[model samples]
Target: MFNPKLHAWLERYFYQPGYFEIVISTLLLPFSLIYYCLVWVKFKLAKPVKFSIPIISVGNLILGGSGKTPLTKAIFNEFSNKYKIFIILRGYKRESKGMQIVALNGVIKCDVATSGDEAMEYAISLKNANVIVSNDRKIAIDKAISLGANLVILDDGFGKADIYKLNILLHPAKEPRLNFTIPSGVYRYPKSFYNLADITLKSSDIIKENSIIKPTDKMVLVSGIANPSRLSFIYDRCVGYEHFGDHHKFSKFECESILKKYNADSLLVTQKDYVKIKDFGLKLSILELKTTILPNLIDKIDMFIKSYQISDRIYSNSQKGDLC
Candidate 1:
């Protein structure tokens, strides 16, 4: 199978309807279709949880860069004070053996490593909010419930037929929309899966004003994300942008090489890149891009919480009785 990141590029290129990309997706489309069907069936069979608090899922039918984390934080910011909110992430790339609550001082920490970049980012971005990571989301959701979360949010969960309501789906606002699928394309679930979404969002729209900072001199655009283009678009205006893979664990040597090749004096990276680069203790100066989730979406999200308050009370009481 092609790397998911490479597949994202392939899908974008294939959407151009040229011979090379079309022939590639055509050859691979049969297998991609079979896999999609099998996964679709499995998704249907997966057990779902009925939560007391409304669970909003910010996810993508596609594999990467649907902007789940930014949406999660945006929704949380809207209602954190009005209701206790909890975020559950799948915690990709963590070394932890199994599902565990992210903790520091016996509570969740804002550390970007164990909690996944976006999870930690959101945890820290939202004051007094709970962030939990679990491969088994049911367990994670239960933990959040026990922690007195009145609303639970899942990041990067779309096709999973587990507990999700009020689905907020994000589509990347790049040049191509539906250009790819699995091995040859970036989509994880078929575009039909997007039908499950209650609201459709575009990550490109999240930033109203271009907040990209101008580079002082030569710089390299460092990223460890599925779609480096999103960051690249911002940096293209500033200086030359060099791209890398999603969740790339860059070594000290690699960083040095990138610096040397580009004559780059500084590094601009996504939040996900920050965690790995910090651990490496690289000498490059880093600037992070901030994503702003729009306010109207936040208002609608708040309304959703306010409507679910009574149901949350009953669910909390039921869980207490079961524990007793």
Candidate 2:
């Protein structure tokens, strides 16, 4: 339901300020205050849920396309072998309303319509983990634990004070890191709000510089994501783009139409967008670009996981005698 044009407009207001934008931003400033108040009320009223399992949250302040999806997938790849992981999605725009476990032990049992785009991507790619979709974080984790998930990775759960966990907030590589309320800007919270996170970083800190063509190459960058412009790294070229709305479903015709219009040498796509493409049967020679976390970041994350795991064990072991 998010309009791509409005998304572009917001990006300019938040990160790319000019004379006209400044005047517009000033007009929207009053609305931003109201937006901020609503956010505070929502979180304040939200019930905080706690789980014994370690939670690693990868989220963004600038809304979707902050590259959190790739980051979440990367972190899951790193820790899946050691932990029975569950990635929780809100199942945005799905017909269903409750939690559904789409994958378990590397087997996918649900389709994209039920699990939403991001959840389906995880269910499809990360065979070793479970993907559960639910708005209620507590219920999702409860189901996760019941299904043998020892760790829960929250998708888009930054400042979701409902659950006490390790939160990593993502900023785009080139974004000036604007923190305004929705309607006025992409950020739901203020700039100072990132301090609430365990780690505040750019996607560059963890993203792998995956192989791609130079900026001079004539490639067509095609995407249907919340933040299509965030793919700027791949756009370091004479790249023509075909962007769609957030969670936009691409038809087979649309896919072919784009390729025909651009007539570029190579095609580029996001992992999330690729799933939809496959479903639509638009199989072009596409370069799949995914960002990955850095090695040092892995170590830092591992340490946090270990610290939580160790304390959990100590508490579990200590409580044994008390139960007896």
Candidate 3:
């Protein structure tokens, strides 16, 4: 059981810069050296698979929540019916051995605890769309194609040497894009990794302009996410906030704590945080961010896809149905 305080301290050091940080980073060089070597070997042996379908990856260098799921949802919304959209995840935190296909009809079901929290969130959010989780992304893409999917969206996959073409990198808003290694900071790789990006972007501006919640209402901001600050920025003037871990499971005691902690007319939440406490038995007025992208996002993404190599099914969005 990791305490919230330790998580907070790690998150603080994860972003802050100091002499100790420099020294630790220096010590961590050997690990990076090993990672780089593996990358090199993987690069040498890895054969870029050319799929009949166009595989577009939306990812980040950070270790956890950088809003990639929201962006993926945005992309899917943009092209779901317009094109046959299939989403693939690496299944980061999930627990199964073999690959699995998640099908949620009226009930919400997922493999998040094993597949990873982010992947689970994506599975739930895009319930209407086809979501698959597999370790080998290329294998997942192949499976999607077999299932009649024309376009596959690689959720949170980048620098993945195995998948080629149409790489879009996600950067956090507050964090400066630099060469900080993992465990020390959110970055999974170095700043040089940005070189692989076709479109480099910050999540802050995107969230401010597009999140669904309105600023006029008095609401309690409840968060159990990796980057609470980003969500805080969106709900700055909210009456109160109850913070939790990245994937915290709220006990009955904690739910009671929330009820005792704040006095507000309603509650506001990020999609990530919303899922955790939704069934908490507290009938507070709840609000959620409508996942979407900035204006002209569709046009830009479409034009970029046209330049890539994909099959005819890629453009066949003529299906007379919504995301289902």
Candidate 4:
């Protein structure tokens, strides 16, 4: 199902467009237009269901990763002390079905295969929050509520207009040259849709602290994530690099063969990739990238939480017939 060459081609076609790329994008415009109309209709017909607990959604307009997981972790860190936080997402490319609890109160409950890489990442990173994965987000939210979650954070949840949430959209640092929807380009929605978000942020809004301790001079880099070129800083230092489709599960043989083929002493991988290969008993240097939300953005999030709490209290009182 996952073709590495096709993925690479799509990435280039979407982001770095030359003459041929532009012509291909032009040919695909009709399909993109149809995709756009479907999305518009979905939004218009959506009757978003409001939940009792406050929900914060971190999402992006692009097809691939836009640092949503790190942003979600940052938010969880900020509010975990005050509320019983639960992180919910549609476990992309997992083997399991129905709702699965990846972690509970910092303890991992399931393996990567059941939880997926992103959910497993949350499970391992956030010590105080619960992590759940399900195809149906509403079902996941209900499960979180039952587990006594005072607040919910939804990963990649912007598309779900059926659920009421404080929408936080991340704008990628590198905008696509073509800027068309699927089949033509990477954008799931147009740039104009940014106005609908409660709070919109850019890659610059978050701070990244890279931790590479005693790094090898010319190791081989093996990564399975969207936009591998985003790590060009590290890639620049590597002797060679092998990129797989996003969330590609690597076998021990594949890893060993890569290292042997490159004739490299050390291997480099991202934190997300590390979780999967950690049990293989292979020596690896992880690129631990710690991200934190800017102070102004934290303040904005606080304000939204306060407003939501106030409105929720008023609605509760009205339901109880306490206000006449």
Question: Evaluated with TM-score, which candidate comes out highest?
Answer: 4
- TM-score pick, better of 1 and 2: 2
Clashes of 1: 4
Ordered by TM-score, highest first, the candidates read 4, 2, 1, 3
Preferred candidate (lDDT higher): 1 or 4 = 4
Mark the regions of model 2 whose C-alpha exceeds 4 Å error after superposition: 1-8, 41-47, 177-179, 212-220, 232-240, 260-267, 317-324
TM-score of each: 0.80, 0.85, 0.78, 0.94
- List residue ranges in candidate 1 displaced over 4 A: 1-14, 103-113, 123-126, 175-181, 203-205, 208-218, 236-240, 260-263, 279-287, 293-295, 312-324
lDDT of 3: 0.66
Which pairs in model 1 have colliding backbones?
A: 181-185, 224-246, 224-247, 225-246
Is 1 or 2 the stronger prediction by lDDT? Answer: 2
Q: Please provide, for model 1 over 203-286, each residue's C-alpha lDDT reduced to its tens digit, 9 standing for 90 to 100.
A: 545874334343446667776776665664566533556566566657778877777777777676655566567666555445
| lDDT of predicted model 1 | 0.67
Q: lDDT of all predictions, in order shown?
A: 0.67, 0.75, 0.66, 0.88
Clashes of each: 4, 4, 8, 0
C-alpha lDDT of residue 194 in model 3: 80
lDDT minimum window of 10 residues, candidate 4: 210-219
Tell me the deviation in Å of residue 3 in model 4.
5.4
lDDT of 4 by residue, 1-324 (tens): 457788677777988888888898899999999999999999889999999888999999988888898889989998899889999999998989999999998888989999998898888767765999999999999999999998999999999999999999998878888768887888898767898899999878889888864477768899999888788887777889988878989999999998899888777988888889988987787788788989999898888888888999998889889645
